[model samples]
Target: MNLELGKILFTAAIADAVSNSKDFSAFVCQSIEKHKTCNWGDCDPEDSHQNDLSFESGGRILSVYKNPAAHEDSEPKIWIITEWDRSITTVLYPSDY
Candidate 1:
């Protein structure tokens, strides 16, 4: 099911990147669509479980999306988090968290 994203937010660094880079901005937009539609990107099994539960349990939801060009062992490219109350959703780089 497609979920509500509530108020969307971005950290300064992410906002800057999006504003400055068209490719990255498109990726972020697509990632957000995936997130709201429950695709959950590259999140682990545990996070997948939590995301599923959050749909019914009113828990926080987390989605991790990776940059295919980045090293597999590197930190995630982005993290999208929707608050438990669904009052807000944020898109940020992991380091920005």
Candidate 2:
């Protein structure tokens, strides 16, 4: 994605990780509009919330493979083992991946 959308995604991730109230979470709703495939795994509907955790980041599809230990945890901690197609600008925010 473009720089603005990347920033918005970063902001939304921070919001998702921290916010407690519904009002606070609403900001991310608009921010992620550019990302057509914005998936939050357990946080969204359809009950296919577990197992595969994937989403769009910086215009590319991002997915995480869960280990047995990761699945056992309450909150799934993510680490970017590798990427598909990435832009140079996206590297600045390593924490996002």
Candidate 3:
């Protein structure tokens, strides 16, 4: 699957961690791959308003959802978020709507 980084708002410490850890990057990639096969209901069953999908890999949690900025009638753009532990969550854009 194709993946792209969005408006990344990482803290300095998290930035350092990302730069220093190849494993984290790999986990993020794996998460994206997992996101490809995930159905909307995979993340939460009752939360039907948002079609966010999530999966776990290498002790990290990753999610993919529709980009809020995209128009309702336009082609969908997917946003990816990888949570490395509890403190760091990286957001990405897989495609532009």
In order, candidate lDDTs are 0.88, 0.30, 0.41
If both were scored by TM-score, which would come out higher, candidate 1 or candidate 3? 1
Q: Could you tell me the lDDT of residue 46 within candidate 1?
A: 90
Which tens-of-lDDT digit does each residue in 5-74 have in candidate 1?
8999999988987897777788899999999999999999998998999988898999999865444554
Judging by TM-score, tell me the better candidate of 1 and 2: 1
Residues 14-44, model 2: lDDT tens digits: 4454365453234334323322233322223
Candidate 3 colliding pairs, count: 0
The best candidate by lDDT is 1
**What's the TM for model 2?**
0.22
TM-score of each: 0.90, 0.22, 0.33
Number of the candidate with higher lDDT, 1 or 2: 1
Could you tell me how far off, in angstroms, the CA of residue 68 lies in candidate 3 after the best superposition? 28
lDDT of 1 at 30: 93
**Candidate 1 versus the native: TM-score?**
0.90
Q: Which of 2 and 3 is the better model by TM-score? A: 3
> Using TM-score as the measure, which candidate wins?
1
Candidate 1 error regions (>4 Å): 69-76
Record all residue pairs in model 3 with backbone atoms less than 3 Å apart, i.e. clashing: none
